[model samples]
Target chain A: MLLEKLQSAVGAGVILPDGHETFVLNLGPQHPATHGVLRVKLTMDGEYILRAEPVPGYIHRMQEKMGENRSWSKYLPNTSRIDYLSAMTYTHAYVLVVERAAGIEVPPRAEYLRVITSELNRISSHLVWFGAFLLDLGGFTPLLYAFDDREKILDLLESVTGSRLTYCYYRFGGLCNDVDAEFLTGAREFVAYMRPRLAMYRQLVTDNIILRKRLEGIGRIDAELCRKYGATGPVIRGAGVANDVRRVEPYSVYPLLDFKIPVYSECDCMARYLVRMDEMEQSLRIVEQAIAQLPEGPVMGKVPRVVKVPAGDYYHAVEAARGRFAIRIVSDGKEIPYRIKLRTPSFSNLSLFEEASRGMMLPDALALMGSLDLVIPDIDR
Target chain B: MTPTLDELNQAFLRLLTPAPALGTACEMHDATSCEGKGVSPNPAPTPPPTSAPVPPCRIVEGKTKGYHFDADLAPDQIVPAGRLLDERGFAIDAVTGVDWLAAGQMEIVYDFYHPVSVLHVVLRCRVPREGAEVPTLSEVFPGANWHERETHDFFGIRFTGHPDLSPFLLPEDADYHPLRKDFTGAA
Candidate 1:
């Protein structure tokens, strides 16, 4: 019955082949491997996947409609909730769009602070991805190590943001609150501590023969496939396209700061893993530079009590941990946006799973999904 | 050397215009002009006290630097324009729908970004509110498939020729589009 439904939904010509006995496997709106409420309907022929379709939307919250219903400033909390793992990036993107549309100038100090917090948040998100990806590969120890580092970062962020996971710290012109000396020192110290730990991680996991055997050259996605599927972040970088939004479309203090985008041409699970590992180090460098060049000014900029965007459409894209996090706002000279569209990278990135997993073994397909680093809520939102 | 923004703009104008020889007369209204009139082609029924005079329709600089190209294409012209952009190496970044309730229209916004040249083009088209329909760009850039589906799920704008316009970020059995301006869900 499920196969018949899938056939009618996806079309008989595309999913099923002639004379091939295949059974459909529902991978879950609840399975542990998916990491969230995401279900992948897999057409399997004895342990090999003939076709895969990801069924998202278990956590759809109508975030865009919420944006229209609420006031301009009231929508900040929803941004973070979309992708809790890298909440800062989402908040930053939302704030930046509103700022640009309203012509609110952020102080240089605020810009630096935003970059520092956002990069730190990137590191925390990558740590979670690292932990979860390894757990998917059956290595339980790495999750502990990854979380150990993630908790410290979260603590540092919580000191200012007031919440650990779904942070709503960024305001339109600046942050909700200012960061103090302790946060800066803790960030710098974390950078120093994390640099060596990355090497330890390399020694412990990246170099392990069994891990390499599992990940290397499995689930290859070349550049063309990435372009077709609109895959971004590590998935595209692993395919040798250095397409980081911070670099391609530089925003805030990223252009002023110096860092390298890690790109690998192998286009496999291992390549994606290495790209993310390298990205965490790059994010560390950004955090270090932002701390070193910290500016002094009022963190919050002057703005009207009631924010009204000039009647126009605006687009702003920021590099979130997962990929290009873009916000499109259409305003009609009102406090509430007429329309709000969140161009989440995870949605585009996760769409590639169907094309990427075809003809691969079930375990290898799961590995590929892990390397994609999906945060399901983001996709559904 | 890559083409300059002006050259790209001119090329886009040439491609989108029904006839290149018609020139400036055939140019669509600038996005700012449409904005001044409250995102409608027609003037607002009752202008607000502070409403500024509408500007002429022409290509103008966007607020964000490097985002130089902004235009409103007719619904019929979007597919050809999208194909031109795809040929020029601009990837589809996002596709979204907007509800212009007062104007009684639904708008589709397509954002395309050129990786190397650092150019961002925003293409917008509007359809009637009751039954919105727009051409699908999934063939030009396959990434648009999911985006179109999401837009459909939100606004109920049907994408002609899309292989699968199934529910994306909504429950499969959802009967009503939630993002339309009129949808006042279980309040």
Candidate 2:
């Protein structure tokens, strides 16, 4: 049926020298360039793609269904599972909606701690993206460097959160636990250590002509396209729109901290690449400032014993590693939520691939996909 | 030129203002009736019977509420709302359904965020649970294609005029909608 729609839109095919027409090529569900089990059914006319339809849902966990079944507090652990790459931010978004609905006041110290940990997580997420993305583009060394830096962040986070990957660190009103002085000192040292590494990464990967040729002027997505598809975070930032949720929507203690939303108007893969690279530096800055201005107070907020959110709907979004990760909760003034929608950014970001990758070379299209910094579990959720 | 939250709020009000005679009666009609009623059966249009003010279809500014501007719109009003918000440079965030099973109604919620400003606009419309359907916003906001399909997958809500409503995040051949309150996992 997708083929019929494509055929109706762009004829049956372009006759090749070999007398064959455009044929369908299933790209993933298990391919390295995809980064996960994301399949793209590409109707290829030789090396160029006529259309690229991403077949998602290879890992649908019914995350939203679980939200309805479980009690409000019981669903906290599931938030991290939606997007493992940036579990803290995803958890923060879920925690926020419930807090707002229940009228729970998170303490100032907890807010600052949330900001510090989230920014550190963002840097780690970006580092993984930086490495995996470079690896996707055929540069393996950066992944090693990227994970090395990322490992330090994981260690710091693990000291507080306990788990390394799918972190259920954030609680209803505040965080699961308070960050001690040792964790704070480790974060500060990690930030200082990461600054020069970013410069080195720019020298090693961004300066390379091969990566430049692979990314520059390839898979160019403008601001209008982003708005149409609701593509957020670095994708929109790379398109020159400073739509960062932290800056635009003053959630957490972000309004108190000063940071620049790295926007590049070039709207190419390179622009998206450069945006993520610069964002890590900016995350380091926020982590640095947040630590220095860290308040002396309690991390956990006062709350009722049995959590029952009021009968109303609430929406809260946080700047996750991929984009603006949002959560919409419909409560029935009961312990269990009526409905919960986890709006993962990659879901929206990946939706744009079909339209954006039209008529582009397969390699360039994959480069564009890598630039999207997709976590397939997030999209599949 | 990023419009401030106030500007966007005012713009939404101006767009949603009742068009004199063409008031809220249009809310009850389904998509087929709304589309077919382009050529009204009655040649001479009669003035709306009720002088009682149109309910708050306008955007409600609420800092306490999760969204800055929350409006309960009629099912038919979603497309125009989408167009107005789209023109105002608001990006389509997410579209999902809420099942008020006890009320025998299903509510479709559309969340929109301004790319340049600090505003989250939520548009919600309720329809009867049996044979639930709403006009597609995929034409207005292409990003809504997957969202609408996912909503359909979970709640069995049909998005009329959706290019392809093939099951998203569900098996293509799957016949069950799992997220409905009464859905039993018997199969």
Best by TM-score: 1
- Candidate 1, what DockQ? 0.51
Q: Provide the DockQ value for model 2.
A: 0.36
Alpha carbon lDDT of each predicted model: 0.84, 0.84
lDDT of 1 by residue, A1-381 (tens): 997786566434433456556777889988989999999999887688988998899988888888988999999899999999999999999999999888898998999999998999999999999999999999999999999999999999999888999889889899888998999999989999999999999999999999899999999998777776667888889998888989987889999999999999999999999999999999999999998998888999997899998887788888999988899888888788888889888898888888889999999999999999999989988
Colliding pairs, model 1: B30-B57
- The C-alpha stretches of model 1 lying farther than 4 A from their native spots are A1-19, B1-3, B19-34, B39-60, B63-66
Q: Write the per-residue lDDT of candidate 2 for residues A1-381, one digit (tens) a residue.
A: 996696666556666787658878888889988888988999998788988999898898889989888899899989988888898899899888888777899998889998888888898899889888988888899899889999999999999989898888888778878988999999989988988898898898899989998999999899999999999999999999999988887788999998999999999999999999999998899999999999998888898999987776778888998999999887766688878988989999999999999999998998999999999999988
Compared with the true structure, the alpha-carbon lDDT of candidate 2 equals: 0.84
**Model 2 TM-score?**
0.91
Report how far off residue A210 is in candidate 1 (Å). Answer: 1.8
lDDT of 2 at A309: 79
Q: Which whole-number lDDT from 0 to 100 does residue B43 have in model 2?
A: 26
Best by DockQ: 1
* DockQ list for all candidates: 0.51, 0.36
